[model samples]
Structures are given as C-alpha cells and as structure tokens.
Target: MLASPLIEFIAREHPAFVHVPLGLVAALPLAILISFLTKHARPLTGTAFFIAAVGWASSVASLVSGLLWGRQVNLIPVTGYFPVVASEKQVLQKMLQLHITASLVGFVIGGLCTWLLWRAWRREDSPGFAERRHAGRRFWERGAGVPALVVALLWLGSWGFSGKLGGIMVFGNEETNKAAADADRAKRNDAEADLPIRALDYASLEPAGAAPERSKAHGDRWRRIWVTASGIDDYQAGKPMKPGAYAVMATFTDEKGKPGTEPGPLYMKETKADGSTAFLFYWARVPENLRKEVGGQDSVYWRSPDPKLITCLGCHEKDATPAK
Candidate 1:
C-alpha cells in the first residue's frame, strides 16, 4: 500500500521510539527485586507505578507507529515461496496478536498493582491509620507485586521475539546471499576477479528514464543505468545480451546527490558462463578497489552471488528485454 509522507516518516523512525518503551518496561522487574532486597519500599513502589504508566503510554505509541509503518510494507508474499498467498499475512497477524496481547495484559496487571500501591500510600497519609496502612502495604508489596513482575517479564519476552521476527523479515536476505557465496566461493571469486574488460561509454550511453531511476532495490539509493552500445542494441531489438563479451554498467548516487557526483557504488554486469548466456554481477566503489581486489586487474569487482540480494534481477530480468 502507498503510505502518506507523514506515515512514511513515522514508520521510518519507529525503531527509535520502540526502544524507549522496551527499556522502560525492562527496568521494572529489577526495580521491584531491589525494593524487596532493601527497605526503601515506599519510594520504589511509587517510582515503579510512574514507570509503568509511562511505559504503557509509550508501548501504545510504538504499536500505532508500527502499524502505520506496516502500511508501506508488503506483508503478503508476492512470490510463490509461501504455501499460500497469505502465509506471510498470517504470520504477521500472529506476531501482532502476540505482541498486543502480551503488552495489554501486562499493562492492565501493572495498572492494578499501581492502584493498590496508591491506596497503600493514601492510607499511610491518613491520620491514625497506621495499622490499616501496614496491612495495605503488605497486601500490595507481598501479593500484587509478584504477579505484576511476572507479567512484565512475559511482556518483555513476547515483544523481544516479535522484534526479532520483524528484523529477520527485513534483513534476512543478506544471510542467504552469504550462504550462496560460501557454497560456491571459487566460482564467485573467479567471476569477481576475472570478467572481460568490456567498458561502456558512461558519458555517451543514454540515461535510463525517470521510471527506472528510483528504487528500494539498492536500499534508498538513486540508480541510473548507462548501457553499453551492445546493450542498447539488444534492448532495442527486444533480445537478451548476445552470447558474447560486453559489459553493462550502473552508477548509484546517494538519494539526494547528482548523477555522477558523489557516486556511491558501480554495478557491472558481464557475460559469464557462455552457451545460452548467463550474466554475473560485480560491484565496487572505485576502479582502484576493484583492481586491488582482483590483483591489479582493471574493472575487477566483487560479484553478487545472488542477484536478488543486490536487487539486480528486478530491472535486468524485466527491462533488459521487452516482454511480448
């Protein structure tokens, strides 16, 4: 779903807000334990109540922010990797359910305990209610406090797991890319270190239109393609790159930077493994780094073992040749 600019900004900044509540709630159990160990029970209980109230408010804020952020995310699997089209949808729903259930339940329990503590404090303030205050204090400190602590612990665990799953969903592909590289290190090394020196005239090649200039493919970077003479020919003819030597280069600029100035990375696709053609992807910041990596070979760069990891396939597979 397309998110509004305000929603997008909040979603992008959700991580920072989430940690605040998580930290506040996490400190509650330790404070309770210490209050029991020492005799500073009255002050600690008031502090715990205040912390719980703030934590509850912050948790609500974070949850709302996360939902707003989720609007921009693809919760449903677009590819047929899942058993059902809504498998990811189901998983996300469950995570949200667990997180919400744990948080609200903990908040309610902590709130009840806070009220009990407040009542105890009020009794202590009333004149000639020493015995009543002592009884109220014992009831809350010895009884309600234990359950509240347990609920806080459970909430922490539930939220931690939910956050872990969310992180895996977002950044998990890097692990897959690393595994592929490890599985075929020799092939990857050869592809990166030894592609043919088929350079394209970056200055002369026609720049890709605005449609292909922006993507989340390179993690919030601006990408512009500068195709080779042969690449342009194949693209015009609605054919793949001919099963021969040639290079296609892409220059990445920071999201706000100009086309060539402050270029972040250089992506080069070269023909590798001939006979019904396959292309390998290479990347580097400067030609010097590429040369150093490949033993002083110019145009040498580190190849992407999995193109999807580096988001090369989305454009290359679709836009390189027009579909019938």
Candidate 2:
C-alpha cells in the first residue's frame, strides 16, 4: 500500500493543502469584526461570507489529505476513524488521535459559522435592509453576525491547535528529537556489536525441509526450518549443531486445524562459542487476535537474555529435534 505513487503524492502534499483553509479561517474573524463598525455593512458582510464559505469548502480537501497521509504511514488504522492508542507510552498515536479530532471539530464549527455568515449577508442585501439601517443599532449587533464571529473564533482556535500538533509531527520537538536520537544510537550500537544480524536475514539461509510441516511443539502451527550452512548437515543427521551454528524457524498460524496463510513468529536458535544455546523470537506484525500473546503489542522482538524468552527455554533445554 505504501508503494502506490498516488498515495505517496497525496501524503506528501498534506502539509501544503492545510495552510490555505487555515489562513482563510484565521482571517475570518477580522472581516466579521470590521463589518460591525461600518454603516455600509453589506459589502463587508458579503466579503466575510465569501471568506467563510471558501474556507469551509477548502477544509474538506485538507481533511482528506491528512487522513490519507495518516493511513499511509500506518499511524491510523485502515478500518477506523481514529488511531488505536493501546497505552500512554504510544505518544505518537495519542497525538494523532487528538489532531484528527481537532481537525474534524474545526470543520463542523466552521460549517456552522459559514452558514451564520451567509444568513447575515443575505439579510443585509435584502430590500427592507435600507429602511432597517436607519435604526440606532448596527445590523450585525441584532443579527447572526455576532454569533458567527464567536463561532469563527472557536473554529480558529481548533485549527490552530491542530496545526501546532501537525508542526510537531513534521518537525521534531525536544522530546521526539531525543527519542529519535536514542533509537538511532541503539540501532548503530546493535550493528557494531554483532548482535544476531544473521537472524534478521534468516530467509537467506538453507531450507531444512521441502515444505512447511506441522509442529506440535510450537502451538500446532505449521513451520519451515532454515539452517546456516555450517549446521544443515548436522541438523539433517540428527546430530547436535556445532558451536557458532544457528537455525531459524518460520511459523504460520493454523486454520481449521491446518496451516493458515497468516504468518506467526520467527524463532531462532544459536549455539555460542562455548556450545551454550541461545534463542530469539521476533514477530514483526502480530495479528490483532493474537495480540494478547505478546502483551497486546502490535509487534515484538525478543532475543535470549531477555526474560521474555524464558518461555522458549521451558520447552527446549537444549537443541531438540524438529517436531514431526
């Protein structure tokens, strides 16, 4: 989905589209305020109505672009209106939810404000307006113009806050910048530390079987085992893998007691220099129904020495034969 050129262009242009409606809405209050001070209020009120109508209309485009951009980045779910923020630690998701809410609120309030302005403008342009203009009070003071100004201010505030959030999302604030730097540093450290880089590219290893087989030891899921060149012979011979050898098992969930199309988790076993075995488990995109297995995480990656792998240790004290 991310590879589509049209989606990429629309997502990229979200920031540009928002400014037009925002600028017009920001200027709406001043136009309405000026209409109240003039005796010839028709022209000024008409101008205010035009600005409000155009701003509200243009906001539809802005909202669409923003939604598409959010979906493209995976911040917003494909099936939902708001992001699913499972926890407080999901700062980006929480912020995105608020940003979407604020934008929608602004659109609704802006629509109402536009209607009010249109009614006021029409009243000023009516034939009886000249006779009514002789009254002591201004036309706006007794009509929908005042209410429109109040609602316009509210519309401005909502979009202003939404813009602030959008800006932070685009350009990192101190907290986001620090988080990004820390993540980058950790990634660099992992690369330099020689931390199971082979496990990440397990698909490049030699396949141990002709096709996937059901593994009763692994939740009855279908699994395909792959081994490093140094270990495939030993694995096939039912001999213990030598030190410095490793194997990866790719698993798929079951359907009607058979292998399903949805992928499960990747399990890796590595024999260290001392012949001690270590395990790694990675699930890049956990199915929604299986989230409870990984503490409701959308994705997970855990290596040996992480307490989370104790469950794997319980089943295999050492390298074991593949389940038939």
Candidate closest to the true structure, highest lDDT = 2
lDDT for model 1: 0.53
lDDT of 1 by residue, 1-324 (tens): 233687777777777787877787678677666544545555766676677667767777776666665544533122312112222324444454554455556556556655654554454445664444434555445422565567666766766666665565445556544544564775566533464243334556645444435445544456666556656666556666654434444555454443444454455554443523244444533455444433343433444442233345555563254242
Candidate 2 lDDT over 191-301, as tens digits, reads 623345677688999999998899888768899999999999999998779999989999998898778999888888988899888888888888878876776668777
lDDT of 2: 0.81
Off by over 4 Å in 1: 1-3, 76-85, 88-144, 173-324
RMSD from true fold, candidate 1: 12.9
Segments in model 2 whose C-alpha atoms lie over 4 Å from true places: 126-130, 138-144, 186-249, 252-324
Q: Each candidate's lDDT (Cα)? A: 0.53, 0.81
